[model samples]
Target: MQGTILLTGATGFVGGAILKRLHLEKKRSVVAVVRDSSKVILENVPKVCIEQFDGSTQWEQRLDGLDVVIHAAARVHVMNDVEDDPLAAFRNVNVEGTLNLARQAAAAGVRRFIFISSIKVNGEGTAPGSAYVADDVPAPMDPYGVSKMEAELGLRQLSLITTMEVVIVRPVLVYGPGVKANFLNMMRWLDKGFPLPFGAIHNKRSLVALDNLVDLILTCIDHPAAANQAFLVSDGEDLSTTQLLSRMGKALNAPRRLIPVPSWLLEGGAALLGKKALSQRLCGSLQVDITKTRNLLGWAPPLSVDEALAITAKYFREHH
Candidate 1:
């Protein structure tokens, strides 16, 4: 046995993908914590041990004997405006829960603490020509991003007083089969073969595939460079929004049905609805240079965009 790896959110999109790979490549034991794990979370990963650990419970015992902890659990929603307070709800889980677990992991002799933070922590929306690097100051606009930023800061502070190595991975829109939210909406559109006018819009954005991110996370658990460091990871290949959509359609076996709508028209429409910031999120370039990660850890993104998209499409076809 290569010791135990405790995974929070093991049944989640990114967490499940990582857990799936860990059992395949390594001899270590993985303890997957889930609220209500489905059969798929247990399938294929024969070596994974299951644990019921919601964020509400105390974490000291849960982290015991674990060599590494990959925290992937969070309240991931686009917007939350409840009667009381929206930001408070996210803060309770994303910020408080994360720090609470990290404190326990540190007490339990956990070697590494891998945090699955979002690029939203850097900023919710993008500005023109404002591609950020790892060192740039965060400007999280939304509640989710704000919570994540607080978690990162808290982890850094925790590291000052503990032996647990903290590694934060800030990933931009992660897409693959079983993807949710707007990315999934785009698929429904492409599945119908609806024509889109995004062909002319040229905006480069960085993205991480399931496989690439999973591999990087495993590597970060013990890699010397990843100790007490943050990384902005992608597939190492930058693509314009148009290119991404075209590739996505091709992967799904749908032909590119792009019309040429003026970028200005879309921007104007977005501005009118007070969605200009969101529009930037959709069409703006938030390119991240993974050069530091590559140089420091000697790691690279495993799958190209085409390869990743094909895997996603294949999975979608098998189930649907």
Candidate 2:
């Protein structure tokens, strides 16, 4: 808690929030690793450069005095990757780059290395009543998920024979201020009062707010029990698709006009349009039970879903 912390992906949505939180702390000496220093939106925070996500990048110098390395940088999932071998491409960054950084951090005497993984490692969808836990076996469907799982396995192996402790956090869909992708598109639709056909699609999905995730990462940095452990984190509340849209409408102060369409019809239409993946995300059940995280780390999400959604909505209105 009192030592220097090195953060990667400081320019990303979740990473930006973490960087901002660290800036406000004023207790820990923080250094952000970015591709370009000019793109670092946070002022007064020291930065180092790593131009590419590759194994060849040198990390010892920047990681020298760092007590904790929050490895948030990765080759994020792309809907349509035109790469020759998408799996190999993901492995090059998410797996190879990650292990390289961890190995260097370990050799540099960093005490803890926290890897931010994805819930996709647990699989795509869950049973209606069942929720994912840390103990679940890896069932990564796509290349991105598989790469993250490999990184987790490699880091755990590294922890076994190294002095540095490794902590893996598998977070569900993370949304907050400056959020993009599907969540942002959904918010935009709601803001415009677009009637979505999710009224009858009753599916539960788990999510972590930016603040909650940042708090968990900070807790893992120093918490003795969190060392060499994996945590599945969320807001500890599950929401139906309809409920999520309704909440977004409320946050945006827009009309909640959801058309009551059958789940079968929605899926069928998505399949016809070659949007099966999108449909699964919209109508699938993916929940996580954070009992272990709460029980072990004595941690709870500091923000409720409504409060977090309000913050996201306010930021979107002001910025976009």
Candidate 3:
């Protein structure tokens, strides 16, 4: 049976990945709430309607007979000045706009509402030798995480008050083809035959692939176990920074020469030069336990870390 789905962030990296997958499946009719629906990311799939990012889209009328709503838009940044008002900007889009849509969906009797959140809602970085499970307390640290946490709380609260189902997905450092910024920088360095100075730094981190995340999102669309549940998601595999970079390099046909840099020295330099954010990226343990997501939803991340890396490498190879 063909169903109707409303997807925000449909043009973004992770969301675009989801849209690419959805394009292949003819089972559902997907309508995206885009900043620009005419600016197509994928061709010959379908037309994206509703050309805005706010709650004023009269979504209540449009959401009529919809099966699911995927809220994947949010304010994203690795670092921000504390003095600046990122929260206000995010709230306008993330918090209030999200609730507005969810409320409209609930009013229209939509079946499920899926939210794409971040592990930053749990903690900035996973503690050493420990991973966050579904039951762990949420202690959001930054403005972005705090806002996401608040949105999660709002969704949970709304679910309690309404008949709408809510499913939340937390992705950790999702990397695949078409990735940008820090992850891309790492790939670029590897592409140029530069070895990352991260060898021998054994810190485990969890990551989700673009394809795997799409699979999970589709699964969550109708999965009964996702109702009113907050689950931590990972690739079901953890690797050190060096290992991840190495796999990426191999996938790109780039040389893999890793230099052993002491973790302490690297971290110390970052801390000294206001580069702590980069340090966290280079050396941090951010593992998440996906046991609950698997047990409850009967779903598993489809791609192995290596498989995802290879795909990303291939993407760079083909594109470059």
Candidate 4:
């Protein structure tokens, strides 16, 4: 904790929040690695700009004298990815690039390499009550998940042969201020009073607030128990789609107009429209068991679901 910390993806949602927290803690020995320095608004934080972040990128000078390297930069999962070879694209950056950085960091005598992985590495969803634990066998379904899974594997292998400790943190769907895509759209629909068909969605999902995730990452930075270990993180609470929407409605002061559409009917309709994956995400269960995370590192999500939801809603209303 006394030495310099190098953080990647400083402009991203999770990374930005971590950078802000580090800044608030008045840690001046932090170096932010980014593709665009102008996008990073945190003052007094040194930055090293790299135009590209693939396997060939060099990090010798950047990793020098660094105690911790938080690798948050990756080709994130997106809906309907347009890449001709999505797996290759993700592997190029997520796997090869990550391993490349880890190799260099180890050679440079970096103490620890913390990776921000995704729960997709544990597969898409869980049964009604069962949840994904830290040691679950890898069952990544898509190219992105496969890439993250590969990255985790490569990091673990590298750690076995090197002195640098590796920590992998796999978080569930993360949402907070400045969230976009589906979560934002859900807020929009709620604000507009659109009648959603999620009233009957009894499936539970585990989500992490940006604050909670940042706290976990920071905790992993120096915790001895976290070294060479993978963690499954969540808000420690699972909510049904209906419950999530109802909470959002309360946070936004918006009327809930959800209709009790049968889950089978919704799935069938979505399959007919070629939106089966989207429907599964909206109406499926993807819970994670964080007991290992808690017992090992004594870590618990510092923010409640409703508290984080309200913060996210407040930001949404103020900004949009």
Find the candidate with the highest lDDT and give its number. 4
User: Taking the tens digit of each residue's C-alpha lDDT, what string does model 4 give over 1-320?
Assistant: 48888999988999889899988887537888889756745878888898899999988688888899999999999989999999999999999999999999999999999999999999999999899999999999999999999999999999999999999999999999999999999999999999999898899999999999999999998889999999999999999999999999999999999899988899999999999999998888999999999999999899999999999999999999
Q: What is the per-residue lDDT of model 1 for residues 16-89, given as tens digits with 9 covering 90 to 100?
A: 88887887876788877776544456654432333423356576466778899899878785632563766888
Clashes of each: 0, 0, 0, 0
Span of ten consecutive residues with least summed lDDT in model 4 = 36-45
**lDDT values of the candidates?**
0.81, 0.92, 0.82, 0.93
Error of 4 at 35 (Å): 0.7
In candidate 4 the C-alpha lDDT for residue 237 amounts to: 92
Measured on C-alpha atoms, candidate 3 has an lDDT of: 0.82
Mind giving the per-residue lDDT tens digits that candidate 2 earns over 93-203? 999999999999999999999999999999999989999999899999999999999999999999999999999999999999888999999998998888888999899
> How much does each candidate deviate from the true structure in C-alpha RMSD?
2.6, 1.0, 1.9, 1.0
Residue-wise lDDT of candidate 3 within 169-241, one digit each (tens)?
8888888898888888888899999867788778999888889888988888877778888777778999998
Flag regions of model 3 displaced more than 4 Å.
41-57, 81-83
Enumerate residue pairs that collide in model 1. Answer: none
| Deviation (Å) of 245 in candidate 1 | 1.5
lDDT ranking from best candidate downward: 4, 2, 3, 1
Deviation (Å) of 209 in candidate 4: 0.8
